[model samples]
Target: MVAGERLKDRYAVDHLPLSHQGMGEVWPARDTVLDRQVIVKLTASSVMDAALAKRFRREARLTARLAHPGVPAVYDFGQHKGRFYMVMQRIEGIDLADLIAEHDPLPVSWVAAIGAQISSVLIAARQIRLVHRDIKPSNAMLERSGAVKVLDFGLAAIHGDDRYSRITQSGDSLGTVGYMAPEQIEGSPTDHRTDLYGLGATLFDLLTGRPPFDGPTPTATVWHQLQTSPPRPAALRPEVPAVIDDLVHALMARHPQDRPPSAAAVYEVLAPLARNLPPIPGVVSDQPDAIRAYAAMVGQVPLPAHHETRDSTTAEYDDPDLATRQAEARAQQLATTGNPRAAARQWRELADRRASQFGEQDAAVADYRLRAIRLHAEIGEHSRALRQLHSLLQDRIAVDGAGHPTVQAIQDEIAKLTQGGLDRSER
Candidate 1:
């Protein structure tokens, strides 16, 4: 591919390449048909075998199906001069590798924000049974809007042609040195936990400007990943919080099973720390930031599960006495597994259903609502708890008078939520 070249009479390629890798080179181009800027990838002539061609198309389809803000959208793909070419959305941002170089030892809040965003991408990919074998700073782009995008989804198979798809003929591994998990080093089977380990390595670097284990050689790095234990982030940076340090350890555990069970769990831990972000000068601008403003309102309250209720159990049940045994079982499991927010929401859902059948003054309805209000206060959402309590108080007074036992219980909850807060016994 040369400067001022045209591909399929659609894109106009630039004179120079944006970046070059083992299998292909990314070129900054213009889609003359759409009159928009786009990124075009041209594969190397030497790597254009029948198998690579098939895998390239597969990647285009897989990436196109993702439909996420964090993943770039593929526009077109076809062969040009016996080399495969792919046109994709042009992302204007600095990759995390460069972001770290600019601000070494980033603030804990920024690290948590980026990590949580990547975890969200992983969770979405898991739903489709797609695994991002390689996850590192270079593949994570931090957009100017303070959003993190996980790049190069399913690109590993394209990176490793037929000969090195799983393992090389020379018995070499097929993963990144610093971020590869133990199973990858051993040439064993891998799953989403493998990506979790890579996330751990990425977060460690973000917090300390270096990976958990830094070895001189590739073999040395593999040895450290396999045998050595990761050092505590707090030791390197005393400001690192203890909770985040422990989460990093759990993510980087040698055994995949020892890691956090899912990406949602990791997000729950990271989301709390992803607040009050300090902007980096020259890295991000302040004007017209839509995503941040949108996020501010989204997390203010727990959204009601209208769609879920229609599918799980609804207020329009044929039998007024029917009990949603399945929802009850799920609520118990969520409460027992350190997910009080989800459990509380489930109980609130139960209260609404019971209220539709029996009156709002029913003892069963009051019990479920009280459980949710307490759970909300325990998590420090005192305002939401108070609002719920006041609404319940008015409903009870209208039905059973102001001096009733249920109305008094609701008043007491409002006082506890507003004044000294929930006691140890209440929590």
Candidate 2:
């Protein structure tokens, strides 16, 4: 589905607005029957096949049977005008990917908590003989109340089914390049352990702000997954606790047998670091606490020093405070240590707190926002930085008009990103 295109003349689902795209376009709509907001996922048949459609419907039914707090409730499923669609509870909150992209290399506790919660969901699915063939960050969504939801059961199947073997093989080569397991890349039979590997990849991306392996092509990426042993998460960031490092490596072992036997086991490992009791298989825990953990970890960091001139127009920017000065010093120290991921994380926290304490319109708020954007870009959070830049540019343009210098600068950055101006380190 193209960006900015509106869906027309749909009755059961109203107000269809395209929300995102990759495998398909997700639209936010109201289910008139249920009188609730829902997400309808639509994909062009040319890009999807009959086998894939069957898998989608089957997974939807399987998901409907699941009553876990971490899984989105599937409401309806059908086809219309040759476009396949499924209506599900509208998920809220950013995906872990977006969180990491907005704020890179999240804190150890945050990563562990999210990993444990998602793993717990898988553990529940395992009881019903379902395996989430795909477990990347894109499939995870945060709820408005702050709980995480594991989504996109489009690739899921009953544990032993070979019905999707052919399509899964084809699709595996095309999607989620950085998270596939060796067995998956080899087109071998997959089990719950395959999902574990993907979960590990997801966690690694959150903590290091980058996938352990990257390649110029999908083939090359598969080769690295098959042959490489990525550095332990803490090796990249020494401050990461020892338990997390050991657990992540164990989950990411090249061989399936080497990983924890089940998601329940992974949750067990994460429990202590998370400092919480394990989630009951199907119960929803209080969400505020989870949000606090998330806020603490992916929370925006502080901005570096801005060479302030006497800006008499804005009271907030007239002078810097001791807090801002101290934050700037801390940012510089982290950046200079060659651990920009850590630096980015720190800046995010300070920035978020400052924004709350001050006001959104404050010049200091804008400064912190810009600093977080630049640091995220430097730390390899391209999608996340792009979103932040878009929001900032929109607000600045609204207040200062399209021709303002700040607006122009933002446009220039967007153009550079679109043209691939920034260089990513060779992995």
Best by TM-score: 1
lDDT tens digits by residue: candidate 1, 1-427: 8888999998999989999976678999999998999999877787667666665666676677566778988999888899998899998889988988989979999999999999988876664445677889999898888878888754443121232133222332356898988887787777668888989999999999987887899879888888878667888999999999999988999998899877777888998998898878777777778886886677686757564422322232223233557777777798889898999989989988765433365688888888888888888788788888898898889988989998898888787666655364377
Question: Which candidate ranks first by lDDT, i.e. highest?
Answer: 1
State the local distance difference test value for candidate 1: 0.79
Single out the weakest 10-residue window by summed lDDT for candidate 2: 309-318
Q: What is the lDDT of residue 311 in candidate 1?
A: 32
Indicate the residue-level lDDT of 111 in model 1: 96
TM-score of candidate 1 relative to the true fold: 0.68
Per-residue alpha-carbon lDDT of candidate 2 for residues 286-319, written as tens digits (9 for 90 to 100): 5456665765675366534773212211222223
TM-score of each: 0.68, 0.59
lDDT, model 2 = 0.69
Cα displacement (angstroms), candidate 2, residue 421, comes to 85
Clashes of each: 0, 10
In angstroms, give how far residue 183 of model 2 lies from its true place. 0.3
- Residue 359 deviation, candidate 1, in Å? 48
